[model samples]
Target: MEIIRINERPQQVTPRGVKARAVLDVPYINIMNLTLAPGDEVPSHTTPVDVLFHIIEGEGSVTVGPETAKVSAGEIVVSPAGIPHALAANAGTHFSVLVIKTPNPKNMAKSG
Candidate 1:
């Protein structure tokens, strides 16, 4: 069995400029922990694989397709493939989420 410790991973800046720690990058899935400081954001973009964002701590605004909503810890947000989505930490709080990509795509390039 393999064990992954979230906090032990080095934080890296994503292409969108948000801070994230890659957890898994296997053929079946890709997972990362994304942390956003107050007012930080992940720019809107569409990917080829379905995405799932699970709020791990704090709260944030999530935009999927044409709809946007506020989500707090314990909530899960879905973003289907080919749809634009983004995330932002509330102005006064931090936000942390687990980003999961199922059936990991060969090309993770933004489609839009």
Candidate 2:
């Protein structure tokens, strides 16, 4: 058994410019904590694996495919693979989201 603490991980900038930390990285799933400053945006993008975004702090707008909605702490959003999804912090609000991707994309490709 392994244990991981989200706050103990050092945050790093992702290729998309969001501050994030990989709290759990394994073959079957990848878990990350993403922090967005006020007005910061994560441009729309598609993933090869399904993703679940759990809001942990503040408020934001989450766009999944053609749908967009205001989301806040305790809210969870799902984005299926190959669908465009994006997130943005409210005008003066920051956001912390827990991102989970299942079946690791790289492993999926290898198994295909």
Model 2, span 1-112: residue lDDT tens: 8778888899899998999998887789988999999999999999999999999999999999999999999999999999999999998888999989997886787788
Q: TM-score, each model?
A: 0.91, 0.93
Worst 10 residues of 1 by lDDT: 103-112
| Model 2 pairs in collision | none
* Highest lDDT against the true fold, candidate: 2
Candidate closest to the true structure, highest TM-score: 2
Writing each residue's lDDT as its tens digit, candidate 1 over 14-104 gives: 8788899999988779999999999999989888889999999998899999999999999999999889999999989999999999867
Q: Report lDDT (CA) for all predictions.
A: 0.91, 0.93
Go through the candidates in order and give the clash count of each. 0, 0
Regions of candidate 2 where Cα sits further than 4 Å from its true position = none
All models, RMSD in angstroms: 2.9, 1.2
